[model samples]
Structures are given as C-alpha cells and as structure tokens.
Target chain A: MNFTNNTYLAEQLKIGNTKAYDYLMHTFYQKLCAYAYTLSHNHDTAEDIVQNVFVNIWVKKKKINPLFPIKNFLYKLVYNEFINQYRKNKPVEYLEKKYFEAVDTSVDNTTKNIEKLIKIVNKEIESLPPKCKQIFLLSKKEGLTHTEIAEYLDVSTKTIEGHITRAFKILKDKLDTEGKAIFFLLFNLDVFSEIKKL
Target chain B: MKQVEIEKIIVKYINQEANHKELEELSGWLKKNENISIFNHFVNVEYLTAHNMGNYNINKAKAAIDVKLKANKRKQRRYQIKRFSVAASILILFGFVTLKYLNFNTANQPKELSKKNNPKNKAILTLGDGREINLEKDKNYSSKNVVGNSKKLLYTQDNKTKTNLSYNYLTIPRGGNLFVQLADGSKVWLNSESKLKYPDKFIKGKPRQIELIYGEAYLEVSPSTKHNGDVFKVISKSQEITVLGTHFNIKAYIEDKKIETTLVEGNVNVKKGNSEVLLKPNQQSITITNSNSIKVLEVDASQEIAWIKGVFSFNEESLENMMKTLARWYDVEFIFETPKSKKYLFTGVLEKTNSITDFLEFIKATSENEISFELKEKTVIIK
Candidate 1:
C-alpha cells in the first residue's frame, strides 16, 4: 500500500500521540539508520543522523504546510541531516589527498608485494648519493636532455652526456647483474624486464 | 600537444637547460593545468614506483567523519527536542485542536494508491505455449493463446476443437513468466524464468504430467473427472507437487534451495525424492535440500495467492528477496554491492502496472536499500 494518504501520522504528532510517534519512529528509525550507515558505515553515526532528522521533523510539525507531501518532507529531512553529518564529520585535508588511497588498503597480498617492490625502488632512488642521484634523477627521474643539463649546470654539453652515459651504464649493470638476481629472488622476474620497464 | 613535443620539453625541463622563455611557458602551463601535470609526472617517475600506490581510502575518512557526526547528531537531536517543546507549546495555543484533528484523520485514513505501486512482491507468469504474457497487464483480453490473470496467466491450446495441434512448451526466462491451464480446466500461473512442459491434448488413460524445469508456478488444478487416476503432478529439480484438484502455489525458483508449495484450497501431497508432506488449506510445505526434509507453515492463502489478484504481498521480506520478485515481473537482473543490504526487508503490496523506474523509487523511499536500475535493450540491471 502507498500510504500516501496516511494523515494519522501528522495528527498523532500534533496531539503528541506517544504511540503514533513511536510507530513512526519504529517504522522509519531503522530505515534512517540504514541510510546513515550506508553513507558513513558507522552505526552510531547513522543512528544519530536518523534521530536528529526525526526530532527536527517533529519540532517543525506546526510549520509543515497542510498541502505538503509528508513522505517527501520526511525524505528531505533525512537527506539534509545526512549531508550535515557528512560535512561535519569530514576533514578538509581529506579533500586534497587523492581519492584512491583507501583502495590500496583493500588489495590482496599478491598485489601488495608488487606494490612493495615499487615503493622500495622509489625509496632507493630517493636515498642515492647526492651527485650521482642528481645526474640520474635529472636523466631518468626528471627526464632532462644532456644539452639541457649542460646549459642548466653551466658545463660542456659533452660533459653532461658523459655523466648520463656513465649513470646509465652503472644503473644498467646494477640492475642487470646483482639487482636482477635480488629482484628474481623476490619477484621471479628477469632483471632485464625491470630495466626495460624503467 | 604532440607526444614528441611533450617528451622533448620534459627532457629539457628536467635537465634545467631550457631557456628562460621556454622554462617560463612550461612552468606556467603546468601550474595552470592538472591533466598536463599528471601526464608529465607519470612519465618522469619509474613505472613500478608510479603504479604501486593504491587508490585513496574514502571509506576510512568517511568512518572517521561518521564518528564525529554521530556525536553532533546526538547533541542536535537533544537540543531540537527541547526547542520543539517550546515551539509546540506556542502553536498549541493557536491551532492545537485543528492540528491534532488533521493529524489524527490523516493517520487513520487508508492510503489511496495506484496498482503496481510496489514491485517487490509482484510475480511474472509465462504461458506454456511458447508465448510470454505479463499477468500484470490491464484487464483486457482479446482471445490470444495466452490468458493474463491479474497476477498470473493461463495458456491452453484449443486443439481438441482444431484436432491438429502438437505439443506446446512454454519457457520462462530468469525473471520470466509462465501461465498454463490443465486439462480439467484448472489454471496455474508461473513465476519468472520458469518453464512448463505440457501437451496440447490429454489422452484419456494417460496421467496429466507437467515438468517444471525451473522457477515458480501457482496451481489451481481442476478436480479429476471420472476417477481414471485424475492425478496432476508438477516435477521440479528435487520435488514433485502432486495435486488431484486443489488451489495451491508452488515456488521453485532455481536460486532457492527449497520447493515451497502453499495450498490455498484442497490438499497437496508434496513428494520430495524420499520424503513427502501432506498440506491442508492455508498450509505450506517446503522441501529443503536433497535430503527430503519438509517444513510446513500455516499462512494466509490470500497473501500467498494475492499475485493472482494482481497484488504482491510481502511479510518482512529481505531486500535481496524483493529484488528476486521484481526481477521476475520486470524480467531484470539484480546485484547488491553491500552485504548489509540483505538484512533489509519490506512489508508492502505493489500494483503490477507501475513502471519499473517508479516502483524502484518508491521502494528506495520505504526500504533500506537504494536502487540504481539500467534498462538495456532487452535486459534490466538493478544495482
């Protein structure tokens, strides 16, 4: 049944019918809780959200227009309460961070392993010696041309080229020989695959 | 920008050798744009390093926020209640009596609702002659092979008069329909995605046998005449509904593990492999698993057969269960993203004629679930 014409709820609320209020509360409280939980995934918050919406509705019964659809009004109350809860609970810093961080936590163990390896490599690069790392970082990480590095470093273009070639050879040898073996021991992939991917 | 242009600029920019003019333009553009920065950064970082980070955890953040909101709501509700008492006192002095009367009248009044207002409890019946019929369609019938009941339909061949008809089989799709008429003129309406295998003609000495491949069907089996066995049997996967002449509804959906036979009138002896249950009027027999244990419950026949009258009646049915009901009538698929949604059930009746969209919106309002429906050319997806 639609219950569209159920005005008994309004009448009971007006006269402070405890039973009517209880009935309405019982009928909708769970639903309100569920809606709140879906958005927040917290039981206490959901309960509070529903409870506040109902209290507001009851307080404003006198001002509720005679022609207003009660169901629509009730829904609007719940929605507004949910939004208010969301805004109050949320931190502004969360909005600035990327949205995908939460998803990373839910990944399975196998996926996490690959992720860990990636993190290790990044950390290693960050921890490299200052001069060597700067050259490597500019060539590989920052993606600078030898000519640009020479111009920026105020060195001869040939000297910049020599630095990158030397850096590449060292990086390639480490990864291809000792690095490849270590990576194989952990991840089972060839060192060449890692170097080529890089 | 071209890929080569981007790559060259990135190299130049990274080397810190770009001229002042070039550096100014690149920095300005990168600062002004997000997409460019992402692409540039993505290429510059090591592949493994860039790809490893998982998506941001919105759920955790939401949970934290929810905790704070809960405390706020508790405070707000308490304050609002106190404020309401004061405002209510003032309003009572002005229009207390009128407001109370209106509220009383409104609550007491029976809600006027269009049929098909709720879709969860509706049943779809496909006829046995390879013709699909929506039982929820309006009350007009033009002598088609399929007969549409308010909640179920009946289909039988007039081959006795025509004398040249062959075997006719009706197939119900998952979330499909099946409606059929027995030789003795008893009517049966099938639920979604159910199939009924029956013959056009009944030989005098042969038994009236119909195999229910899948889904549910309500039987109003006619009384056998002349006592030549006069037995009517419905064969499903693990259960068989044997009724001589009775009004009962048997729901044997594929997903359900039990075959439920709710008898409205007369008696139905449900034979499940090795076990059987004798059911009386208002009694329901459920054959569970392959072990043959049957559970019978006393229920209102009207509630069981309400679909025959074009109304779906549910008693504390879960949202997952409700989705099955809607799936059959509208011929759609349902998927629940969260497990908690299973705990929500709705107790209501929905008219069968309402648009699926309208029905979902109404349920979303009253039930504990949110519905997002996508109707493809031939498939309806409910999430």
Candidate 2:
C-alpha cells in the first residue's frame, strides 16, 4: 500500500520495501535534521544524529506502533539517539551532572505537589524500623500490593501485612501527636493515588 | 479483623476482584482509621508499579516499556537483523573520518577525494587581495599554478624558473566546507571559517608554505619521490607548524584564540614563536593564552576531526562553546536568554547537515532545558 508523508513512509518501511525506505529518508531527512540540529546546534553532528535515527527507524520498523504518529516516533527516536551517543564516550558521573542539573530546574509544577507529599511520607516512613520502612516504601512509594510485596520479599503475606500495619501505625500516631496529622497522612495518600492515575 | 484477612482484601482490591459490598466495606474501614486510610492510599495509587510514580522519566520508561510491549505484540527475531544493520551503519559513519584519514595515508587515494568526501574536508584558496575561492568548485578552471588531478588538486608554477607564483589568500568560512588539490597531488579539506594563504603554485627548491589565519583544516598530503624534505608549513596566529608527508588537521580559529594542531598520522613539529613541540599520531598540540608556549596532549583523532567528515565532535564542550560551533555552521547569531546558560556543557556527536531545531531537540531530550527560538531577520534568539 502507498503511504503519505511520515505515516505512509513509516508503514512502507515496515514491510521491507527498499523503495519505501528511500522515500521515507528523503521526506524525513530535513525534518530529522531540524530536530537533530536543535539538540547539538552543530550541523555535522546534527546530520549524524538524524542519520542514526533514520537507520534505527528502518531497523525497528516492525516494533514501531502502527497507530503511533511517525513524526512523534521520529522525534523520540532522535532524542534517544543523542542520549545514547552522549553516553558512549562521556563519563557517567559527568553526564549525570548535566542530567541532574537539567532536571532540577524544570520539574513540572504538577509533579512538584506530588513530590512534596512523597517527601513528607518518606520522612515519616523513615521513622519506621528498617524492614518496616522498606516494606512501606515498596508498598506506598513503589505501589506493590501485599501479596506482591510478600512474593518480592519472600515472606508470608501475613508478615508483609505486619510491616505495612506497623509502618502505618507509626506514621498515624506520630502525625496524630502533632495534631491534625491525619490531614498530612491523607495528603500523602492522595499524592500516591494521583500518581497511580497517571 | 486479622491482618491476613485485610491483606487478602487489599490484594483482591488491587486486582479489581473485590465485589461491590467488599469495596464499600473497605472504603468504610479506611475512613475510620487514619493508618488504614494511608495504607489504602498506597493501594489506590498502585504502588507496586511505582517505577513510574513520577520519580523517573515517563517518556523514557515508556519507550522501554514499549520494547517489552513489542515482545508480546510481535516476533522478536524478525527485526533483529534490521536493528543490527542500522547500528552497523552508524558505526561506519562514526568511524568515517578516521577511516578516510587512515585510508588516505595507506590506500590509493581516491581519484577525486571531493567526490568521496564532502567539500567540508577540502580547503579554500584565498587571494592576497582578500577574495576567497573555494578550490573544490574551481575544478574545471585551469590556472597558471593550480590544477586538479584524479583526486589531487595541485598548485605549481608553470615554470620552475619562476621564484614566486601569484600570491592568494584562502579562508574556509565558519560552517563552510572546501577542498584543495596541492601541486603534488595532495588533497586538503578545510573546516569552517578557516583562512589559508599560499602560493598559487609551488616552485622547485622553495619550501612549501601556507598561512592559517583562522579556523580548522585537514590535509591528506601525497607522498613524493623527490622527498626533497618537501615540507608543509602552516603559519597560525600563535605558532608556525611544520610537517612532512602525512595526514593531519590544523585548527586555528580566530574566535578560539588558540592554535590547535592535531596529528592523525606521521609526525609534526609545532613552533610556538620560539618554542618547539613535536606531535605524533593521535596527539594534539595547543598554543594558548598568548603565552607563546605549546602543550601537547594525546587524544582520539575522531574527536578532533569529526568536523572534516561533516559532523560535530564534542569532548564535554560547554553549551556556549557548542553554540559558537553551531552559530558558525548554521550561519546564525545566538542570544542566550538566561545568565550563565551558555556555560552548560555536554558530550555528544551530531552531523553538520541538519537544521537548527534538530540539534536542539536532541540535546533537550538529555537535559531539562526549555527552549523556544525567536528568529529576527537572520539571527536566532534561544529562549
């Protein structure tokens, strides 16, 4: 079947038609170049980045989502390619420094609220015994249910329940002693629930 | 009331297996006890899969998850070869410059290096009067001194009797690519914004000399039988570099304020004013700070010469430095929106043919930089 721009081109690539691959390359060459240039700001590197992305798309055509827009997929692929290229020759620690710096300032406002709640929960969770704290984190922060927690911890579900109960009780009493601590507890819980929805 | 019963119900609820009454009863109990309410919140939040609880990157994890999803959606072996091929192509391209440099040194040089390599690797010829001519495009023109061979472009006087050929200055523009065939069939590729001044043709018994005013250039010098100590000299702002028949690159960008000469193969001696420093393959000599002293460092030739292959090379280059390179190639002006924004540096490789937006998106993926560009006339303001 004939395809249009990115969609048809991506589809044509999937079926092993070499001609379709060429068509896709010519069409997306400039678009990919634009995206790559946006990242490195160097024409030479930008060209390399786009070339890699196109090759990757051709190779991973079958894995690509048919319904997923080709342009979006290309954008994502170009981004991932740059990250991969950066990591290969760069020291991990040095690379992480930029990563953390880039992340620290741009946290989404919506995520910030959840993060604040998680911070509070973590502080209270830390008050628990080490095992209990771990259990609580795996359950509350990691979203593991009692049975899954038992399976992961290799303990009985009853024991897993003990950890959660103890962890919950400690947080409850500490917050209650602080007066209206229940609200804090609820807020933290709400944050977790909100995260699950996402 | 036992913990086992509560645990059972929680698991059932998490699995969405709880009946209506069970759900109501569970909600009622959570409302009554603060601790149970917190515990229930965790269940509601699906904490078991919290790998994506907004703690990590959703898009990245989603991509990974997509890989897992694809395993279930289709056969894996079918795409394996294709993936491998794509990876292979990149490795080949990534190694293209190094391979070309090495091949140019050992293998028979291509009849037309310009056809095999982009003009970015070739050098430009500058007139003494300040007019720059791209030597690659002038292949068809026959001058008194310069001529193009199968792959080599040469500049030589029509008569050995002539001591001086017409003096011309050649500058490779920043982000601009060019090629030149020397008198002895050697080929040189000039990187962005570099200027070179040399004789239109070389006369016998005269040492071959070329001046590098600014920017980077790569040369694939052809070997000769006379070997009359046929020396090639590159005079830069800070130092004078001398080399025999070999493959190497000289970068003396004006804005960089430093002259860098990298040897990919063979040997060269860099003279920083009065001081002399020798360089070997994969070695870089730098004369910096106007001190007129040179420092030699061992380095990867690919990192230094990727530009000649039409790609960018970064060794943890700062954002400001990266932008300067970008500005030259894209021929745009950069205005940083935030203070100290330009100081950011990252290690990455990008090709030199993509548009401005492509590079930005590639870097934006690695870091959290909100970038929006405003174009006025021809300048780009990054916000």
Candidate 3:
C-alpha cells in the first residue's frame, strides 16, 4: 500500500503535492543559498538566486529524475545562475574558467555524479578525536587563528596546533588515497560545517 | 619543515592568505602531488565572504509558493475531467496524458448516412458454429443465450442444458473495443486490434480459461467462491496469468515482442515455460517472446489500466511506440519520413477521445515543428 520514496515523490508531484515540494526546499534551501552567496555575495541576491532556482524546480517537477537525488540538479542550476551573474557583472578570468571547467560534464547526462563523497567525508571527520574535531571545526569553519581557537577552547596554543595536525592525519590515514578524489569534489568548508551541526 | 608545521602551511595556502614562508612550503607540497589544483579560487575571497545576505522572510515565500501550487492543482484537475478519454468506449480507461481523439473526416456526410466512414462502435463476434457477425454501435442482437448491445456483449447460461463448453471468439478491430461479461459474471475489456476467445458458458467443475490472441485486455475475474473454487486463467502469447479472483491488464501485442501482465488487485501468478513468478498488487510480470524467463517488477498499476479509463498515459514513451498505439486505435498506418522522429520521447497524458489529427498535431507541437503529419487515406505520413 505504501509507495517507494522516489516513485511516491514523482506521483505526488504530478498531482501537485506541496509537501514534496516543501521537503525538497527545506532540505536544499540553505545549501543552495550558501552556494549562491559564494556567487552573488549579497544575501538578498543569494536568496533571490536560490528562490528562482526553486521556482524553476517546482515548475519543472514533472521532468525530475526520481532515480537520482534532486540536490545534484539543484546544485547544477545554482552553478549556471552563478555563471550568468558572473558574465553580467565582470570580465571572464582564466582561473575562474578553469575551475568551472573542472566541474564540466563531458557526458551528455545533465546529472553529474558527485556520489557518496559526503557520507565518506563525514564518516572520516566523525572518526577524529572529540577535542581534535572541535578544534578542527573552529579553525576551518570559524576561520579562526590557532591562538583564537586556543582561547576559545581554554587550551594552550601549542595544544591547539597539535590537535589540528592529528585531525588531518586521521582524516588522510582513514580514507587513504581514494578519499582524495572525494576531498576534491566536496571541498567546501561551509557545507561540511552545516553537516557537523546535523 | 616539520610535518606538523607543514599542515598549518597547507591550510594557510588553501585559504590563499599564506605569507612567504608558507607559500614556499606549499610549492614544495604541490611538487609532491600534481593534483592539488582544486583549492585555488581566483575570485576575491573577501568579497565572497563579506557579501551581505538580505534577511529572507520564510513565511511570505512559503505562502506565495502554496498559492501557486494550489492554483495549478485546481486547473489540472479541471482539465483532466474535461479533456480525458481513451481509444475504446466499451472497456477500461487508457493512456499517459489526458487524450482526446483527432478526427480526420472533416467533410460533410452523405444524406443516406451509410456512405460516411466516420467512427462508430464496431467489433466482430464469431459464434461457436463458425458464423461471424459484424457488430455495430448501439444495436441490440441476441443469439441464443448471448445478447449483444452497442456497448457490450453478454452471455447468459442455461442451467439444465448439460452442454459441453463452446468457445466463441470476439475481435475488436483497430478503431474500437469490446466489453464482454462472461456467463460466470467475469468482465473483460479488449483494446483495439485485440481478439479474445472464451467459452460461451462456464461448465460446472471446470476452471475458467480465456486466451488473448493479440493486443491488450483488462479483465476482472469473478471470485472463485461463486465458481466452486475454480481458478481463472488468462493466456497471452508469451505468458499465462492465473488468479483466483482479481483485476489485471495484459498487453501482449505480438509486434512489441514482449508480453506484460500488470496486476491491479490481489495476487496473480504469471508463468512462462517452467518459470513462474508471483505478482503482488501494482506489480508487473514481463515475458519476452523469445525467452522463457519472466521478469517481475513493481509499477504504478494505474498507468497500465489507464487505457480502460480512456487515457493514453505515457511516461517517457518513445514516439514510435506512441505512434504504434495511435495507429492501432485510429486504424491507420504510419509512414516515418525521418528516422529521428522514432527516437523522440514523450511524457504526457493524452485523451483518447481526440482525433488522430489532433494527436498528430500535439506530437508536432511537442517536437517544436521538427515533426509534422499528413493524413493520406488510411496512412499517416510523418515528416
């Protein structure tokens, strides 16, 4: 009697289920906003970019690929919006073009595979020592100096430095060489920080 | 440099705010691995990080979205009712989109009315004695215990006849469908270009069996409780479906090279050769014509039975397949002038009540003028 999640989402959306749209929005809204902010900078503009992306998604719900996660398409659309805004406001730079090309889809499929990197990266991070993890989050997410992190944790600066060294070693050692590919694709610090909250 | 300090230098380099000592160390690290290129962002990090994000009013945005979606639902529901139908009038609903047939006969009809070739409810009924009757729309004809009306054909059994089973064949041509209630009260709807052969009346202590020679048929089997525990069995070209009492659809068009039975309610067992698969409600059993193996998978049963409700609902169907379906219902042949037209995929619910011309126009519109249709006699030329 119960429909599977992907099929259910498509069928429900066909009849205009606001709850499915709501689930999609709430799950990806913040991440989309953060991505837009990286592009447009202005929060109002970022919100506008993300909102427009979602409106397009809602209008095109019938075309959604239920087999794959919807977030990948959302991310791609946000990227396209960023490129459009970039073209309007500034001249093209080679370094910017190269990095954008790094995300390029060689294949015809619009849905690119960023697959399973989030879970693997999260698991590797969670495996860090509690103090090391806390210090690591403070340093990368807060963009704090070691001395500031030391003050925040009530620890010596040298101890804070040691925790950072140990955290990187554990992450690198646990995931090994394969994790390097994952590390490259999902290199955004803010998104990982948001995951840490969850 | 000590490895611990090297980590700090790499972090500073990643942030792109490293001084001379760290920059030199990062170049050394880069030499160790050539793939460390993803870290560099050419844009000004200060501008990206310091940009103001205006406060977003969550309540207002949600309310605005809610209103838009509600209006779409109301509009879609109204459209579904107003524009929906299938290829057949006697049987189940059909198709992907809400379909309305396109009529090609636009010229004025003759006064005599018999000369007109307009659409009418028609099918062929072959009695057990090899006598064939051409059935017409809304005409009442009773041959022995069997009664035929424009809508459906009904068979009533005589209790004390003690006669053996007499098989009768009903063929619904490409332009129409046939709905028939068996002597045992089982109801069946045959799609256009389909043929069903069943016993005229159920003999006591025998299992009810019918054969779908070709095309599609949706059947609701009468419960076994009334049949003295006799199971109903439906035979398609490639597979056989056995059920105690249930509703299901079998699409076994010989041209498609695959026979599929989709269960709508209760459990049904599909058998191909020695391999048998049990299907739950909303599950489908697929049997390829050349293979004995049957594949079972879950599906939305509503899509399979949509034909009975007069909708040709397609979920990413190729143009060739859709054209074939239309060809059967409208009793027309398709001539493809371009090979690319076959590869085009469509997803929509088109009503069956629409004319063949309208359906072709819809396809042409969806293809953005890349495709156009011309009706020549009984042939539809696609260019």
TM-score of chain A of each: 0.39, 0.42, 0.47
Q: At residue A183, what lDDT does model 2 achieve? A: 52
Q: What share of the true interface contacts does each candidate keep?
A: 0.10, 0.01, 0.04
Chain A of candidate 2 scores what in TM-score? 0.42
Candidate 1 off by > 4 Å: A1-198, B1-166, B174-178, B225-229, B367-383
Give one digit per residue, the lDDT tens place, for model 3 in B1-383: 56556666554543343678767655655554333432222121211222212234566666755665565566445445332233432211222232223223324422232222234568888888899888876678898788877569988867865557788898888868878999889999989889999998877787788999998999998999888898998988857888899999999886889998999998899999999989999998889998999888889888788777777877567789988998887778898999987866666676667666656666765566677988777888989
Interface RMSD over true interface Cα atoms for each candidate: 16.7, 17.1, 10.3
User: Backbone collision count in every prediction?
Assistant: 34, 71, 48
Residue-level lDDT of model 3, residues A1-198, one tens digit each, is 123366676667657788777776766575566456545444566666677676667777678776765566777888776665434324555434433443342111112222243344466566778888788767655557787887887889778767775665565454345445555555776688889999
What class would a CAPRI assessor give candidate 2's docking? incorrect
Full candidate order by lDDT, most accurate first: 3, 2, 1
- Taken over the whole model, the C-alpha lDDT of each candidate is 0.54, 0.58, 0.67
Best by lDDT, which number? 3
**TM per prediction:** 0.40, 0.46, 0.56
Candidate 2 lDDT at B235 equals: 80
List model 2 lDDT by residue over B1-383, tens digit each. Answer: 56556555554554344567766656555554454544433342232122122233223433543454454234333222122212211211112011111111213333332232232433455565666555554355455666552223456535456665666766555446667766655667766676666676666656677776777788776653354667777787758877777788887777778877889998888998789988989999888847877888889876777776666767667778878888777666778887565655566565565555555554553444444456564476766
| lDDT of residue A188 for candidate 2 | 94
- Two-chain DockQ for model 1: 0.07
List the TM values for chain B, per candidate: 0.55, 0.63, 0.72
User: For residues B199-268, what per-residue lDDT tens digits would candidate 1 score against the true structure?
Assistant: 5555555566777777777887777764366688878887887878888888777788777788988898
